[model samples]
Target: MKRNIAVVWGGYSSEIVVSAKSMAGICSFLDEEKYNIYKIRITKEKWTVEVGGYVYTVDKNDFSYICPISDQRIYFDFAYIIIHGTPGEDGRLQGYFDMLGIPYSTCGMMASALTMNKFICNNFLKNFGIRVADSLYLNKDTKYNLRGIEEKLKFPLFVKPNTGGSSFATTKVKAVDQLQQAIDAAFGETPDVIIESFISGREVTCGCYKTKDKEVVFPITEVVTPNEFFDYEAKYEGQVEEITPARISGEMTDEIQRLTRKVYDLVGAKGLIRVDFIISDNQPFLLEVNTVPGMTQTSFIPQQIAAAGLDIKEVLTEIIENEFNAI
Candidate 1:
């Protein structure tokens, strides 16, 4: 029997549009003979599935799509979460699915919760000898010591939402005067903000995933942005150059890939994860880990997948089959 696959996309954050595009790209390659694909658009307004221009509401309790014509409750056998932020990426949806005994295609509740917080994950990796930049953690209501923060971390700082992705509200502060405005802007996205000292170096990212058999690491991609950094514009727009199998030395590539796997194991992440790094003075600094990385025309995962001499269909199939067979 062909298993029903629910491609859960959209979210309660700015990354929802990107998530929709990702779902479309992945769905385009999904083999229809072996599996039945259902596009579940999740948002603050409604949880629905549209078929042939007809919208059917999904039963949140049992995770079933209600058929408008016959009123049949179609339950999904597997859920492929492509949402990049909030409920999908931050563990809320994962936890809900957990309660229903439904398996998903991303990290579990705890791992998602831990990794979505940049301060916690980076500091945790720091303990494992993975170097991360010195940063100040701040909450919306917490009193921030600006003088103390400035004294500890030098100028040319990066202020970003600790729990947000796609560089939604991230800012690069070149001077001390621009700190407050950046913090305020970051707070608009999430409740917490991380202010880290800038590390000038070659920006590169490597993606890794695991199966029941072994872990798979893709070739590293070098990110050369004409902007201030690899911000939203550089990532989604055509403001940056992403070179796969980066121009870095073989030794550095091996080290970052090793570190990337270690971080994945450390966070207990499932599915594919992209780890960003900054190699400054020949030392690789861990920037951040993307649990649900992009899959659009300009995304790095597809580029890395091709550079590694692998097919997107097989790679995505391996991911889906691994989860489906387990159940």
Candidate 2:
């Protein structure tokens, strides 16, 4: 029997386009013969699925839908969440699926919620001996001390939405005068924001996923961007160069893979995730953990999977089947 798989996309954030692209990429990677795939598009308005050339509404009661033509109800066996922001990446969708006894392809509720907040997640990992850049957190109602921030941290800080992704409103502040404007820009996207001391060095990322049978950690990728930083444009606009099997020492690759596994276990992450880092003074500083990483063909995970000489189709199958085996 073929299992029904929901490639859930769209969210209550600006990353909807990225999520849509990821949905297409995932659908292409999954083995069509083994699973009955459906493109489940979600938004603030409604939850829907496209059947044939017509769109049908999905029942939120049990995550099933009735085929008007056949008068048959179709239920999803699993959910492959690809939303990059709120309701999906922040754990809301995971909690919903958990209550319904439906497995998903991402971190659990706690892990998703914990990792969505950059400030809290980094601080939590810091306690586990994870090296992270010094950072400060701020909310829309809180009063931040700019002078204190400057004194405690170095110049050229990164101002970003504490709970946002796709570098939507992230900014690099090189001077005190640019601080206020950067903060405003980040606040425009999210109510809470973070300011972190910039780490200067080569930037690299590693993707990993652990199933019940195997621990797969992909090759590292170096991020080279001409912009001030790896901003929104660089990530989705093809303005950056992502070099796979990063031109680093073999020892460095081992260290990164070790840290990647450690972080995955520490965060209780499920499915595939990408951990970003900046090597300064030969030490890898944790940047941020992406629970619902981009799965587009050009995304880092696909690139790394190819670099590792593994078949993407088999990789997706392993992850999907792992969920059923765990249950």
Best candidate, lDDT-wise? Answer: 2
Q: Evaluate residue 304 in candidate 2 and report its C-alpha lDDT on the 0 to 100 scale.
A: 96
Per-candidate Cα lDDT values, in order, are: 0.90, 0.94
The lowest-lDDT stretch of 10 consecutive residues in candidate 1 is 140-149
Best by TM-score: 2
For candidate 1, the per-residue lDDT at 234 reads 86
User: Model 1 TM-score?
Assistant: 0.97
Q: What's each prediction's TM-score?
A: 0.97, 0.98
- Candidate 2, run of 10 with poorest lDDT: 145-154
Across 1-327, the per-residue lDDT of candidate 1 in tens digits comes to: 998889999999888978988998878767788889999999999999877788788888799976767877799988889999899988899999999989888999999988899999999989989999999899967897777778899888899999999989999997778889999999999999999999999999999999998789999999998898988888877899989989999999999999999999999999988999999999999999889888875689989999999988888889989987777
Clashes of 2: 0
lDDT of 2 at 225: 94
Off by over 4 Å in 2: none
Model 1 regions more than 4 Å off: none
